[model samples]
Target: MMITFTRILICFLLMVMFSNLQAQQLFQLSDDYIVKTYSERWELDSVYQQGTFRLMSYKPIYLAPVRWSSKPNDKPTSDNPDFSSTTSFPYNNIEAKFQVSFKTKLVQGIFWGKGDIWLGYTQKAHWQVFNTGLSRVFRELNYEPEIVFKYPVRWKFFGGQFRSVGLSFNHQSNGRDLPNSRSWNRIIFHMGYQNDDWIITLNPWIRLEDEEDENPNIGKYIGNAEINVAYNYHRHQFYSIITHPFNQIKGGSIQLNYVFPLKGHLRGHVQLFEGYGETLIDYNFRQTTLGFGISFADW
Candidate 1:
């Protein structure tokens, strides 16, 4: 137990060590090669809040109970008649509820002409942390590492600033093997626009075909693209993620988020999720869940 805790501590330290380096170079002026200061941007209630991922809809650290609306139909790999998928999972899922999530950009620099590169990582874990009756196991952990190339653009539509355009390659997986493993790679195009307190980004992505199909039917439930819209007012941040299923049969997921300052460097976070894609294991299972936790940064 002590060894496990030590490892987790080490990981957190490494994440912070790398993220701090990028935070120093975040959102800098491209032409002048000078760093962008917080005073140049809009004033915030807290200086600690001035960081990256301001317009991105996804945040970290959400812990709450989840109820499955439609449980997935089990698939059997072995052809035994009595074979059941639930044999590996006999515990009551209704009692499992906990989460630890975070994202950080490790490094960023000017890459080429008028463009920059950033390396970032985000992880989401569903923990039965408090469910001691179930041996307090971690249910699932999904790690995503992405490298993005961002280029500033001078364009406007709907009277807003067309801030930047980004292209990236992202890979997401649970790092598990065999029956429970899930992984995918995608190419994303990001177009960002901001008007006053409102920020919107359209992320159109295409999944790269793979030789070994882990979750073959994932596209039907998670869809081909995502849209993020966020509005900032005073010290509050509101955001949402929308996805429409490719087919009418399997539904998509919609997540709503609200974050406000609770104390110094600490903010109260509320997450409302409906439909699918709540977790990798529940990618095809429809569910509704609400999580309440604290976040250090929305970026």
Candidate 2:
């Protein structure tokens, strides 16, 4: 027990050491590079001028070599027996994970130059890279594609600026066959606010009625809404995502992340997640996970 404790302590110490080292370079910005405001980040209200069809980062693109889950779901089960896995596989507690997310402007200045439309796609995968005995199979892969129509708002709320409101059609799926398949669709409403370096977003979604439900109880576990908070301080970024069902808070999740600059356009990322819905296959399985790696985008 002492040895295990020591190992964990060492890992934490190393993370702190690297963060400090990388922080030194975070402040060294180029002459032409300008720090962006919350509105500028989304190019809202013509604050940041951009053309259509330009691809941009929608979410944090990251790869973690070490992602440890306290409880690995080897046998994924769902309320729908057709979507539950029949056989259990050997899933490692520690594995590699990666995510890639991007967005492109489809129509700019629509609705009499007040609205914009975007198409976004995000994919995240878990790989059992260290479990060579299982021949290094990909444990789970989730794909999300969304279409958003966003409009900038300029309302004041407690000295903060209400920045934007939007609606999104989102589809998330594992792209798998029966007994391992999981998928869901949602109509999400988005609202964003900004106060100095702090940005907050609320996304409330309703599940679309499907003839053949993949996971009928997914909403009970993954929640119907998300609250995201982000703050930037001297080139260091901190973010948190909280989700919970409206009926109760027992089935929800919280994820915290810290990111600091490492190199040009590259940053070190550390993430901690607790509860359900870390992945599509693990939507109903609760776990605590810690991951350390690098990311190319923020939020």
Error of 1 at 25 (Å): 13
How far off is residue 10 in model 2, in Å? 41
Q: Residue-pair clashes per candidate, as listed?
A: 0, 0
RMSD of each: 8.0, 10.9
What digit string (tens of lDDT, one per residue) describes model 2 on residues 104-206? Answer: 6778898879788887777899999999989999999887878889899999998899999999998888877788878888999999999887889999999
lDDT of 2 at 151: 91
Error of 1 at 127 (Å): 0.2
Model 2, residue 206: distance off in Å is 0.6
Looking at model 2, the pairs that clash are none
Best by lDDT: 2
Model 2 clash number = 0
- Runs in model 2 deviating more than 4 A are 1-35
Q: Where does model 1 exceed 4 Å of error? A: 1-112, 246-250
- Cα lDDT of candidate 2 equals 0.81
